[model samples]
Target: MPAASAAHAVPPGRTRLITRPFRARRIRRALFCPQILVLGLIASAGAAPMARAQDAAVKEAPARSSVAAEIRAQVGGKLRDFYGPRGFWPVWVEKDAVGPQADALLKLIDSAEADGLKPGNYDPKGLRRAIEDADGSGDPKALARAELALSKSFAKLVADMRAPSRAVKMRYLDPEVEPRDPGPADILRAAAVTSSFEDYVEKAGWMSPFYMQLRKARADYGKTWADLPDVAVPTGLKLKPGAKGPGVGALRERLGLSPGGGYDKALAAKVKAFQGDHGLTPDGIAGPQTVTALNRGPKYYARALALNMERTRLLPGPWVRHVVVDAASARLWYYSGGKLDGTMKVVVGAKESQTPMMAGMIRYATLNPYWNVPPDLVERKIAPKILDGASLQKMNYEALSDWSANPQKLNQSSIDWQAVASGRQELRVRELPGRSNSMGRMKFMFPNDLGIYLHDTPSRDLFGKPARQFSNGCVRLEDAPRLGKWFFGKTLTTDSDTPEQHRPLPQPVPVYLTYLTAASGKDGVAFRPDVYGRD
Candidate 1:
């Protein structure tokens, strides 16, 4: 509603200019609180009725450059697709000046930083100035530019608020589901009648609680750490608790402490907290990795958290029962009733064969599973050895017609190993289940075209490393026995000469393969390395 205290300066049928004095917070509060708008004209101190003035210019809109051409130069062409269908009518301005609704939108743009979005992306300052500059000019060209800019900004904000559209890529198929976006007309019209702009943003509700948490982290970090001088500890430097030296001083200063050479309990606690947040070992020691993580500024955290927030938005959840494999963090979590039921260390895909982000339902369990060696792996490792007359039986492999467990072993002399290596002859290689089998004792199957699944590995020692990206693509569980027990309610066992067995789950469990580099949990905000360079 228009301010009740102000006089009705304009006639009932006319629109008003934006020159009316308004308290800054009041204007912002009005934008957010009221979910609906009354669409009353706002009166300026001295300007004439705005609707009467706007009507003449709007009618002349048809005689000018094509609407697309006119607006596309100011607002992007892709963004113009929404407003263009309405004959490029201005949505934010009243005649020449921006109205209170536009004021609310402009404020939102500035405050979007809370969500790690750059306000300048929507050109709020430029649009506001342009609206003021054109207010008294009575020039159609300038007013049109202002209108186009406002609409473009509004559309982009609405779309992005619903889904991080920029994060949508063919490579990250895990975020395959699209969040719903309201039609532009519906949004813009709602803004005109909304009781409060803040209410509208809350009503839009695009961000999940996870996104809000990252955003909160960004805000908290910005308040205290954004301006701190960066710490420059040399790589490989290690500082244990109570160690006194230059490294300790760097650590102290980095933790916002007044420089003291002595490392104290207080400092150790801070270091441990930082370690926990950054997915480190949290030993209260300043190692090279921990030092590097501490040295990063809020800007880095903001951007990283923002990207991860986008990644989080791509996932479907609040799941009743599901598993999440955080590829970047190399952690697997099983959730039921919105609480963590189980978690385990995981070895994900290496940089070269980066783990794919995807979603699927666990279909069944493979007992005494045969490892169908991928063609690429066969060509890379096995081909040269077998071509030199190495024993295939000693290597624990047999030639198979396809991925199915039952296959007659091909005669080694009859096979042309070189031809197989060069792909001239197609060959399917399988490794029989054994104590040293690559797929361990069992494999958890899921339906996806990527040939990805969860399995145990013989390289249990590799899980000891802090950065465990050792797999080709499939995830390797650190605690397979525990996982199997959770899945089947029994211990996993292997019988010699046993055929591969598939057993369906009592109920399917949803699985999300994600690459989030930052998120929130009971541990507060946490960050992981962007192993895939996704950020």
Candidate 2:
């Protein structure tokens, strides 16, 4: 009866609730309730899964950020490594790191490499031909020469990377570590005093009596001398109160002359002599400049000595020699048979117009070469002159309207010269090849884009000045003709009829123009004034 009732109570599509004992029914309800509660709790916890997924995404973001930072650091490190010591990478580095011109240089570099022009394997003629065919326009030969020079310069830089360490680490003397109050004798000892001036006189090389007396004065005053204040004479050697003698005695007392006394005076005289030799105003008074000359730091002296040694090493192992210009010193040395035969003062480029430090082989000497004014000069100086109608004819400027944008299309001939002077139209001017040309009579070409080359200047008087910076960029040599003769292996008497062509020497002479603050000599290392103030 109960089964029949349950079946009759079941609705369509509904499961029948089976009837059982009261205790069993209660147990089944309890189990079903617990299962329903468990399902409800799982449905509520489903929202937490999204939060876990978000947490995982956040963790991954940091890892990606870290990778990006690592990549940037590596790039910067490589750039510094390539550019720091050698300094040849500045142009390329600056181009790549900043400036709108970066793409142009990158393109040039790519084209150069793609054409089979490697650093050490430069084929100027082949490169020129390839560049001409590649672009189908522009001066390919000039471009090729420039690229070859850059490659060679880069190779030299690579070679220099293998140079041994010449740098010295300087340790600052700590005040606490140093003696709180050093005695006079202790101070003298610390200053590297070996013996008295008298002892030096007796044992050292032949020195004049005057020099010996100076040394004595220095030694006598060494005891009372405080810090050597450049020009201050030593102190402590009490002279006769009334003796009116040479300033040597006074200088000695000021210097704190030590026993066996001539060291200080000798040092002072040497300083004065050095000043005189270097064309400084020799005042016998040790000023900042004098002190700098006397005690150039060990690091500076060491670097100078190292570079000089390098120069000597690079000299060709033969009797054939050429002119070597030490740009930093503003001096040109003539070398022959592995010896410096003569030296002459030169007016090097100014601080702003720094002569580049580079090495190259002089390929050709152009006599009476046409001076194509650098584009910079043309844009800056000549353009203004043309606009002002500043007598371009007087200046031997040839107006080349043919190169203008609308040469044949526009009526350039109808443009009034006087009216155009009033900001009417653009103009271009070029100087023909002649004596008055900016590149006077000759130009020694190695081809570099630093706009650096040895050339003659129309303004010869500028050479006589102490500092020459009158060029747009090119290096103007005072004796261009002499240099041209030396390079071409021809006499100055050679006539104009001589064929204008490069006469290759039996062996190419490598010319290096270097900048150094100091150089080594027989006596010791000599410090040079930072003529260009590069450092």
Which model scores highest in lDDT? 1
**Model 2 deviation from the true structure expressed as Cα RMSD, one decimal place:** 34.5
lDDT of 1 by residue, 367-436 (tens): 8888888888888788889988798889998886655536677867777889888977778888888888
Off by over 4 Å in 2: 1-283, 291-320, 334-347, 399-429, 466-473, 492-507, 520-526
**How displaced is residue 300 in candidate 1, in Å?**
1.6
Tell me the TM-score of each prediction against the true structure.
0.56, 0.43
CA lDDT of each candidate? 0.64, 0.40
> Clashes in each model (backbone N, CA, C under 3 Å)?
15, 28
Q: What is the lDDT of residue 421 in candidate 1?
A: 88
Evaluate model 2: give its lDDT: 0.40
